[model samples]
Target: MSASPAVKALGWRTPLLVIIAGCTIALLNFGVRSGFGLFLEPISIANGWGREVFAFGIAIQTVLWGFGQPFAGAIADRYGSARVLAVGALLYAAGVALTAYAATPLMLNLTLGVLLGMGLAGTSFTVALAAIARMVSPERRSWALGLGTAAGSMGQFLMVPLSQGFIAAWGWQFALLLLSLFALAIIPLSSALAGKAPEGTGPKQSMGEALKEAGNQKSYWLLISGFFVCGFHVSFIQTHLPAYIVDRGLDPQTGAWALALVGLANVVGSYTAGVLGGKRSKKYLLSFIYAARAVVIAVFVMMPMTQVSVLIFAFCMGLLWLSTVPLTSGLVAQIFGPRYMATLFGIVFFSHQVGGFLGVWLGGRLFDASGSYDVVWWISTGLAIFAAIVHWPIDERPLVRVAPAAVAAE
Candidate 1:
């Protein structure tokens, strides 16, 4: 089919605007989630709760977010991303507000764990990425996705420290209230994705069919397993890395900067992965990325402690961090097509959350019991190697389906 004049006329402006909107939404969505780690020590100290209590809440939030992701993605796939994001913004705002008022662990868990997690599922990458993936052409899809994910990382980098400053200057509750207000900014950006899906392009199969299809695929299982490692590493690091640093006799600010640098470097890494993934073998690249992570973690653990060394480790690790997102999402698009992209990706994301729950919750449990995060770091390093191996054998190809229309059509 010939390109329409309108499609030709879109130039870079439309995609740029869409990408900007996607990045903005992602920044706000994941950024707040990333900052939740900062509240652990302060909140526990103030409320007279044990560290594990608040950690459990955040861990529950991670699992709930994963559980809610596919549903949110299905909603975005069926309805549109804007509606999902708009609703998510409100839900997120409410959750944060309620969390500020939480006096009991149950209240905290309900507000932060369930509400905020569900809110993020709606507004974060699952929705924003699916929206942008649909808007761009295949060749540019990875690039655009990388850009959006990078923006999310940038948000984490910029906002984590900002969150710390907020806590330092104003107290945790007031800081959360301010962050909640900042999250409201996503409402306006949500409009950019309204009515963006191409006409007549949607899920070819019902959710049941898609689930059955994915369930039967070996590659799908591999992808899910690999992604679970990604979640485990990320949640473990984000939730506990700062405290680990403090325990190591380093300043908490050092951990904060380590995270920020990871965010900053990921912007470059994610974008590069997207660009390179378009040209190279995405599965192979994903495998290599995971393998590299294992290597980096090993080196970091063995190296003597210094601020300079830690910063370098953070930068190298950051590059491999979210680089998986673009490749994984791109592979889903390649395998299943965009019609069921969001829903399929959401299922994969669910596995990731399961891992996230273990990572966050177990890290806390182990720390309280053993007085160390060493075992978790070793576990994370091992999982990275396993993830790399899992992706290596995945057949990156489309599934054959029985034609639904007419037999002769095939």
Candidate 2:
């Protein structure tokens, strides 16, 4: 699909601007969310609640984010991403601010779980990536997606430390308030993504048609299945890794640094994946990433517990973390075209968040029961292997409707 007339009117500079704005949104959205793990201990201790109470709130957030994504994406696909992002920003800020005052589990669930989740659905990767996909040319699309993902990584890296420092300097309540301000920044930035998807030279299909076509594709199902593993792995680590590290008799700062290291290393990993995805088989690349994740987990668990090893594990996992995002999103665009990229990818992301819910919730349950994260860690490793195998057979060819006439005929 071609970019909207208004987008084209701005000429070459438009693409660059869109990328910049998309990256900023991604950074703020992911950065703020990634640091939630840092708050788990403080919130639980303050409220005299069990870890499950806080974990369940985050779990609800993940599931609602998934459930809300398709609707948010559909709205963005029909209206404009700008509107979706603006609403998301408002809700996100409100949710974060209210979370600071939440004394009960139900309050936390409504504010952090439901409202924040819905806000994330509107403002995060699905919306931003789709907008960027439409703004750039086909050849550069993967790179653009990678840049956007890396920007999110940059946010995670920068924000994690900042979050910890905030909590240390002030209090968890003030830290949440400060982050709400960051969420509010998304409102003005959303303006940059205004307008509909760029029109394609070929006849456009309705959203229903796109949905039906994706439902019938084996590759799409495979992508959904594989992405679930990514969600599980990332959510579990992001929500529990800090505590897991602390449980191992290390300082809380060690966990923060580990997460920051993951973010830092992922910047390189995500960008490289984007660059490589353009030139290589994205499916194979995804397969390799999942496989490598299994290996990393295996090694980390086997080695002796030490600060050096933990940081190393974080760095290695970081390399594999979020590396799948650009490739997976690019695959959806490559197969279905960018016209319905957000909606299609949002459906895929829904599966990711399902895994996220289980990952985060289960970590808390298993830890509370067994007093260790070992079982969940093993489960993550196994899921990674399963994901690796599933991604192997996905068809990467463009859809028939998007194919050239001669190619379609052939």
Q: Candidate 1 — which pairs collide?
A: none
Per-residue lDDT tens digits of candidate 1, residues 1-410?
A: 65554455545436668778888899888787778888888888889986678879988889998999999888888887888899889989889878989999999999989888888888878788988887778888888888888888988889889988898899899999989986788899898776534442443567678778888889989999999999998898888887777777888788888888888999899999999988999999999999999999888888877788889988999999899999998999888777768889998988988999999988998888888888988999999999999999988876666666755676
Q: lDDT by residue for model 2 over 1-410, one digit each (tens)?
A: 66767576756448778889999999999999999999999999999998999899999999999989999988888888999999999999999889999999999999989999989998887899999998878899999999999999999999999999999999999999999999999999988888778668766678998999999999999999999999999999999999999998999999999999999999999999999999999999999999999999989988988999999999999999999999999999999999989999999999999999999999999988989999999999999999999999999999776445656788
lDDT of 1: 0.85
Which residue pairs in model 2 clash with each other? Answer: 2-199, 3-198, 4-198
- Which residue runs of candidate 2 sit more than 4 Å off their true CA positions? 1-6, 10-13, 402-410
Error of 2 at 400 (Å): 1.3
Candidate 1 has what TM-score?
Answer: 0.94
RMSD of 1: 2.6
The TM-score obtained by model 2 is 0.96
Report the error of model 1 at residue 395, Å: 1.2
| Stretch of 10 with least lDDT, candidate 1 | 195-204
